[model samples]
Target chain A: MSHGYQAVGWSPFKKRYDLVLGGLLAGYLALFSLATLLLRPEITAETLLIRAFGTAALLLLHAVLAIGPLARLDGRFLPLLYNRRHLGVTMFLAALVHGALATFQFHALGDAPPLVSLLASNTRLDSLSQFPFQQLGLAALLILFLMAATSHDFWLAQLTAPVWKALHMGVYLAYALIVAHVALGALQDERSPLLAGALGAGVVAIAGLHLAAGRREAALDRERRAAGADGFVEVCGVDEIAEGRARVVTLGGERVAVFRYEGRLSALSNVCRHQNGPLGEGRIVDGCVTCPWHGYQYLPASGASPPPFSERVPTFRVRVVDRRVFVDPRPLPAGTPVAPAVVSESGGGG
Target chain B: MTPLDVATWIVRLAGAYAAAGLLFALLFLFVLRGVDRIDPSARAGSRGFRWIVLPGVAALWPLLLRRWLAGASEPPEESNAHRRAAAGGRG
Candidate 1:
C-alpha cells in the first residue's frame, strides 16, 4: 500500500517468517559442514564455507524462483509469496558471502585490482570447456544485488510496477548465468556425478513447475466467451460466484475478476496495482478485494484502493441477465466508480 | 585484440563507471535527498530506506539524474492491455 513509506513494515508474521528462514539457513550450513568434515576431513575451512554458502544460495534461489509459479498453481503457497522478497534479499546476502570469499581467495592477491583480476584472470572465450564461468557468476551476483537493493515498496512506487517488475525479471537471466556457471565451472572442476545430478534435478523441478503454471494461465486465457448485442461478454452465472468471491474470465484479451458481493456483481481488472498480482485469485476481505500477495485492498465497485491509499485498477461495467453475469469487455478508466449490477429473485435485468 | 585485452578494457571501463556512479549516488542520497525529488515516496523516508536504495540508485543514477534534471515529479502511469483498453476502445 502507498499509504506512507516506512523503513520496514515488520509484523509478528514477518518476524516469524524471517526466523524460519534464518533457522533453515543455519541448519543447512551445519548439516553441510558435518557432511563435508565426515567425507573430506582434509578440506580447508575457507573451501568449506565457500561451498556451503554457494550451494545454500543456489538452493534458496531455486525456492525463490519456484514460489511464484507454485503460488499460482496452489493457494497453499500464497503465504510464501507474501514475504518472498525477504528470502530473495537473504539469498543475495549468502551469494555475496560466497562471491566475496571466492574473490579474496582467487583474485585479491593479484597485482591488478580484484574485479579486474576476476574479469581478466581467464579470458578463454575461444574454448567452451575453458570458458570464464567466474565472470558469469559475477554478472549474476550484480543482478541479484540490484534486485535485493530495489526489493522495497519504495522502489516499486518510484520505478512504477511495470518498470520494477521488468528490472526484477533479471532474475531469470541471473538464474541462467548461474546454471552456466555451475555447469561449466564447478561441475567441470569437481567432476562429481552426485553434484551434477542434483543440479539437473533443480533445473528440471524449476522448469516443470513453471511450465505447469504457464499452461494453467494459457488455458484460462484461451477460454473465449462471446459478447451479446449489448457488448457485454457473459462470464458466469450468479450462483457460480460464491458470496464474497470472484469468477475470473478472459475478456477483451485480459483477465477480469467478476466479484459477487452483498447480492451484487462488480468486475475489475484481475491485475493488482502492486506487483500485478492475480486479483482474481484473491477473495474479498472486509468489504474490499484484498490482494493475496500484499493484502492491498480495493473497493470492488470503484476498483480504487480504500482512502489513504492511491492504488487503482481498471473497472468494467457488469450486469446480470437472467442470473448470468455479463461484463463489458471494454474496461472503464481506473478508479471509475460504476453502479453494481443487482441480482433479483426473478432474475430481472441487473 | 586477444580476449584478455578485451576483458581488461571492459573491466577498466566498468570500474571507472562504477566509481563515478558511487559519487553520484552519494550526491543523490545525502545532498540531493530534499531536492531532485522523483516522488513523495523518495521524500518520505529516513536513513534506513536511503541505505536500502543506495545500490539501486548507484546503478540507475543516470536515469535518476535525467529525471531529476528534467524536473520529473510523479511516477508515470504504466500502460498494459487493461490500461490500453480502458483509455479508449479495446485495440
Candidate 2:
C-alpha cells in the first residue's frame, strides 16, 4: 500500500475565507447590479462587468499578501495559512476575469488576433514613461499562472520541497510586477480615490506585518544570546549528575544544559530546534533529548536524529578536571558525533 | 443584452462562477488540509478582513478545478503512529 515516498496527498475539510469574501463580493455586486439595473438603466453591460471584475482582481491580490503576518501574530489566525493557496487561486481567477474582459472589450473586436494586439499595444519596451502598462499586467498574469500551475501537490512532489519552494518565491516577483502593473495601468488613468486607498492599504499592511515579525524574532534571538554561557563554567562533582537526566545551567548570555545519559556526560544547546523551546527543560529517552514543546528528539552524542526527521543542535566539549566538570564554551559543529565525558568510579586523585 | 453582449456576459458569468466556485471548493478541501499539515490551527477566513478574501477565492478555486481536472488530492501529513512504527516503535 506504499509507493516510494509518493508525497502525501491532502484533502482538507475546513472553514475558508472564500465564504466570507464570496458573500461580501457577491452581496456588493448583487446590490450594484440591481441598483444599476433599476436606477440608471443606461449603464453599459461591458462597463458594469469591467468595474466588477477589476475590483474583484484587486481585492484578491490584497488577500494573498496578508495571510502570513496575520498567522505569525495570532495563533487563532493559523487557519488563514492553510487556505492561503485557495486565497491565491481565487485572486488568480479574479485576475483572469479582468484579463479576459479587458481582452474582449478592448482587444478582441477591433484587433488583429488579440495576441498580436497585446504584443503590439505595449509597443514601447524601451521607454519607461511611455511603456505600455498592459504589458505589466500581462507579466503579472504570467507569474500568477506559473504559480497556479505549480500549486498542486503533484507538481510540488515532482519538484521536491526546495525546488517547489524556490519556484513559489516567485510570488514576490509577481507581487512587484502587479504593483508596477497597477501603478502604470490604473493609477495612471483613473486615479480613483477608493481604488488608490485600497491598494495603498494592502501594501502597507503586508510591509508592516513582515517588519513586526522580523523585530520579534530578533528580540528572541537577543534574549537567547544573553542567557548563554560565554566561556567555560564549572558544575557539580562528576558523580552528582544522574545517568539519563539533564540539568539546566545558566552561564552569562547562554542557557546550556548538561545531560548525563547512558553513562556518558554531554552538553547540548539549550534552544530546541522546533520553536526554540528550552531544550534543557526536556526529558531524555533512549540516549536522546526529547524537546518539551513538540517532542523533537535529538541524540545527545551528536544531536542528530534519524532520517526524515533529521535535526541537530550545537554540542559542547566537556571535561572533568580536578573532580569537577568543566565545559568549554566554544560549541562543536552541530550534529558532529562526539564522545560523552565519562567519570571513573575511583573519584578524584588524592 | 445584444447577441455579442450575451456571449460576453455568458463568458464573464461562467468565468466568475468558475473562479468563485473553484476557490471555495478548493479552499474547503486542499488548502485547508495544507493548513492542517503545516499547522492545524490555520483556517481560512478567520481574520474577517475583506482583503484576505480576494486571494482566497482567486487562488483556491483554480486549484480545486485543476485538482479535479488533474485528479490530484491535497498533500497529507505523516501519521504519528505510522511514523513511529517506521522509526522502530520508539516514543
Candidate 3:
C-alpha cells in the first residue's frame, strides 16, 4: 500500500501471469481462425471474425465465472484468482471486438443507425425462437462494459466494497442475456449441434461446481453447530482454536469468528466491513484481525478498525467453560466492545 | 411519430448522455482529485490508470456520485437477520 495511485502495482508474478494469459488468448484465436479458414474457405472475413471472437469471448467468460467456485473447491486454483480482473478486462475487449465487427457488417451503411437497427431490426419479441437476439447481446455487452470499466481498486474503494460487489454481480445478468443471445441468434442458424451442446455443457458445469461448493460449505456449518444451554451455541473447544486464529461457527444463521488471542477469546461477525471477506479465514496480524482478501483490520473485542479508520463489524459475547467455547447468538451493533473471555490456566493447556 | 423518428431520438439522447459522462469523468479526475479514493498502492497518478478507469467513471457516474457524497459514512446496516435465522445462523 502506497500513499498514491500508480497505473498498476505489477509484481513479477503478476507480469508472468499476464504473459501466460496473453499467450493463451493469442494461441486460441490463431488456432481457431486457422481451423475455420481451412474448414470453411467459402466463409466471408466478417463472418469468420464474428464467429472466432464471439466463441473466444464466450469461453473466456465461462473460465472467469468458474474461477471463484473452482478456487473455493481447491486451493491450487487460488493463483488464478489473484489477477482475475485482468482476465475479465481482456474478455471484455474480445467481446467488444466481436460486437463492433458484427454491428459494422450487419447494421452499418443502412438507413437506420446501428444501435437503432440492433433494437428494431428483429421486432419478433413475442416469438421465442426468433426473438430480437441482437438486443440481448447488446444489453449483455453494456453490462460487461460496466464491469470491465470498474474492474479496478479505485472503483472498489470509492464505491465501498459491498456496493461495488453488488454492482459487479450484474455479471450474472450479463451471462443470462448472453446465453439467450446465443440460443436465439446463432444456434437458430447453425446446422451443427456442436456449438449448442457446448453451451449446454458450459452452463451445466458452472451450475454443478457452485452447487458442490455450496453443499460442502453447508456440511461444514452443520458440523460446527452444537447448541448449548441458554441461547448460547457451542462453537469448538478452546483447544480447537489456534492462537492468533479463529474457529468460525454458524449459529442461528449467522457466521461468527471465535478468536483465540493472547489467552483471551472474542467472537465477532465473520464478514469483513471492507469487502464481505471471510474474516475467520484470516489470522491476527499486528494485534488486529486482518481480512484475508484485503488487509482491512479490526480489533477482536470491539469489532472496530484501528483508530483513524471507521470500519466496523458486529460483535458477539463469548464465554469459555471447561475448555469449550460458547457464543451468544445475538450480535451487538457494529463497533460495540464486548469483554473478551480469558482462558483459564486449567483450560489453556492446549 | 414514425418508429424511425423515435429510434433516431433515442440514439441522439444516448450520444448526448455519453458525451456528458466523459466530461464528468475528466472533471472528477482533475478538479475533484478523485484519484485519492483509490487504494494507495494504485494511487500512482499514472497515465495508464487514468486511461483504464476513464470508461468506468463515464458509465457509472451516478453510483460514484452517491458514494462520493456519502463520504466515509458508516456502511448501511445489513438486514440478513431473517436469512441468517433461516440458515440456522450461519453467515
Quote the true-contact fraction of every model.
Answer: 0.58, 0.00, 0.40
lDDT of 2 by residue, B15-34 (tens): 77767765664554445543
Encode model 1's per-residue lDDT on A261-291: one tens digit a residue: 8878899999887888889888899999988
Please state the error at residue A80 of candidate 2 in Å: 1.0
TM-score of 3: 0.83
- Winner on DockQ (1 vs 2): 1
Local distance difference test scores for all models: 0.87, 0.60, 0.80
Candidate 2 residue lDDT tens string, A1-350: 11122222233332435576678778767776776578668878976776676677676666677666665566466556655666677777778887888778878876355644665655666776676777678778877876765564434433434455667778778877877777666676564586677778888887898799768645644642121254566765766776666766644345567887655678877765443445775678765787753456888877776554545666776776666777765556557676778766577611
lDDT for predicted candidate 3 compared with the true structure: 0.80
Per-residue lDDT, model 1, residue B74, is: 70
**How many pairs of residues collide in each model?**
0, 39, 18
Q: TM-score winner among the candidates?
A: 1
TM-scores for chain A, candidates in order? 0.97, 0.60, 0.85
Candidate 3: tens digits of C-alpha lDDT, residues A22-117:
999899989999999998899998999898899999999999999988877885786787788888889999999999999999999788888888
